[model samples]
Target: MDQHSDAYFISRVVLFNDQKAFEQLVKRYQKDVRSLLLRLTAGDHHKTDDLAQETFIRAYTYLRSFKAKARFSTWLLRIAYNIFLDSVKKEKRRKNTKLYPHQKSINPESGMDAQLDYTELMKILRPPERAAIHLAYISGMSHGDISKIMACPVGTVKSHISRGKNRIRTYLKLEL
Candidate 1:
C-alpha cells in the first residue's frame, strides 16, 4: 500500500489507543521528518531534533482531527515547516537583541584555503525559494502538494519554483 493508506491505517489504530500502531507510524516517518527538519534548520542538530519531536507529538495529539483529505506526509510536513519558521523567527529576534558580544574582526586566513563551492552557494537562497526547490525537486512533491503545505495557491507554488530555478541558474551561471 501507499504511504497515505498506511498512515490512515495507523491513524485509525492510534485513534483507538493502539500504541504499537502508533510506534509503527513513528518508525515509518520519523527519519524522513528528521531529515526535513535538519535541512530546514541548516544542520542545527538541537533545533532540528526538537522540531522533529514536536512535529510527531503534535501529529499524535491531533490524530483524531486528521480528515484523510490530504496525504499524511503533507500534513506532517506542514507542521515541520511551521515549526522551522518559528525557530527562524526566534533566532532572528535573538540576533537583533544581541544578547552575545559582537566580534568586529574578520580573519583573512580563515578563507585562505576555503574556495567557494558553487553548489553550496545555491543554498543561500531565501527560505521560500529554497523550500520550493527542495519540495518540488528533492522531495518529488507536486506543485499542488506544495501549495497545500505552504498554504498558497498552486499557481504561486509554480511561480516560486520557476523563479527559484531561474535564480539558481543565474547564480550558478548554468544554462537552464
Candidate 2:
C-alpha cells in the first residue's frame, strides 16, 4: 500500500472536502491526540475520548483555514489543549455550585477515581508540565512546537519540562 503525507490528505480534505481524507488524517493522528488527552485527564478514558472527538470536530470545521505553517498534528494538539482549558473552566464553574461530581481530591488515594496506574512521572507533574514533557519526549515535538501548542513561550515550555523532570527525579530519589 502506498502511504500519503499529512499534507496530501489535508489538501484533499481542504480543497475537496473529502471525508475519507479527513478520516485518514484522523486515523493517522488519533493515537497521539488521544494519548495526550488521556494523560492530561489523568487517565479518564471517557473524558479523553470526548475531548479527542471534540478536537477532531474543531479540526475538521477549521480544516480549510489550516495554513500549513505547522505540522497538522501540532495544530490538532493546540485545538485539543484549548478544548481542555475550556472544559477545566466549565468544571470550575460547575464546582462552585457543587455540581461537578468528579472533582479531584487532595488525597491521591481518595475516591477521586484517578487512574494512578499512570507512570510516576505522570502522577507527579502538573498538567502543563506533563503536557510539555509529553509533547517533547513522547510526541517528538520541538520546544517551539510545544510552545505553540501549549500557547506559551518557549521558555515556559523549557521550564515545564525542566520542572517536570526535576520533580520526577526528586520523587524517585534520582536527583543528586
Candidate 3:
C-alpha cells in the first residue's frame, strides 16, 4: 500500500529490485532533497534540480551499498551533499577561478524587503556552514545525523552550526 513504511519500500527495492518501490521512495523524499539543494544553490532552480537528479541517480546505482545504519533521509542527504560539492569543484575547474572574498555590497536601489529576506543572510555563510544550519534547523536534523550527512565529526558539525548562527545573528543584530 501507499502507506507502507520506508523500510518496506527499501526492502522491496533491495530484495526484488522493484523499480516501482524505488520510485515510491523517490516520490516521498524528492521535495526534501530538492529543497535542500535549492538552499545550497542559493535559489538556483536549474542547478538544484540537476544536482537533485544526480543524487537520485547515485542513490539508485548504489542502493545495494546502503547500510541502513542511519535513516534513509540522512543517507540521501549525504549523497546530495557530495554531489553538490562535486558540482562546485567542477564549476570552479571549468571557470579556472578562485573563491573571491565576501564583499559587503548592498545595492542602493534594492527594496528593504529584499534586504530582510533570509536568503540575504544565507549569502554570508559558506557552503558547509550553511548546510549545517539548514540541516540542523530547517531540516530538523540532529548534529549526529548532520555529521554523517556531511561526512564530518559531530564536533565539527556543532562548530559549523554555532559559527553560522553567530554570523546570522550578527547580521540581523539579534541578541539570543
Candidate whose lDDT is highest: 3
What candidate 1 gets wrong by more than 4 Å, as runs, is 1-9, 97-119
lDDT of 1 at 66: 78
Worst 10 residues of 3 by lDDT: 100-109
lDDT of 2 by residue, 1-176 (tens): 11899988888888899899889889988999999988787678899999999999999999888898888888999999888878877887967643323333234343224433444336566778778988898888899999999999999999999987776655544552
Ranking by lDDT: 3, 2, 1
- Over 1-176, each residue of candidate 1 has an lDDT whose tens digit, in order, gives 23545666666676677766766777887877787776555555787799999888888888888788898888888888877777676776878743212211223333324565533444444556666777888889999899888889999888877876766555545577
What are the RMSD figures for all models against the true structure?
5.5, 4.6, 3.1
Best by TM-score: 3
Q: Model 3: C-alpha RMSD to truth?
A: 3.1
- Candidate 3 vs. true structure, TM-score: 0.87
Question: Residue 72's C-alpha lDDT in candidate 2?
Answer: 85
What TM-score does each of the candidates earn?
A: 0.75, 0.82, 0.87
TM-score sort, best first: 3, 2, 1
* Model 3 lDDT per residue over 1-176, tens place: 67899899988988998999999989999998998888788767898999999999899889889999989999999999999988887877888765422223344444433458766656767778878988888889888889999999999999988887777666666664
Pairs of colliding residues, candidate 2: none
Question: What are the Cα lDDT values of the candidates?
Answer: 0.69, 0.80, 0.82
Q: Which candidate, 1 or 3, has the higher TM-score?
A: 3
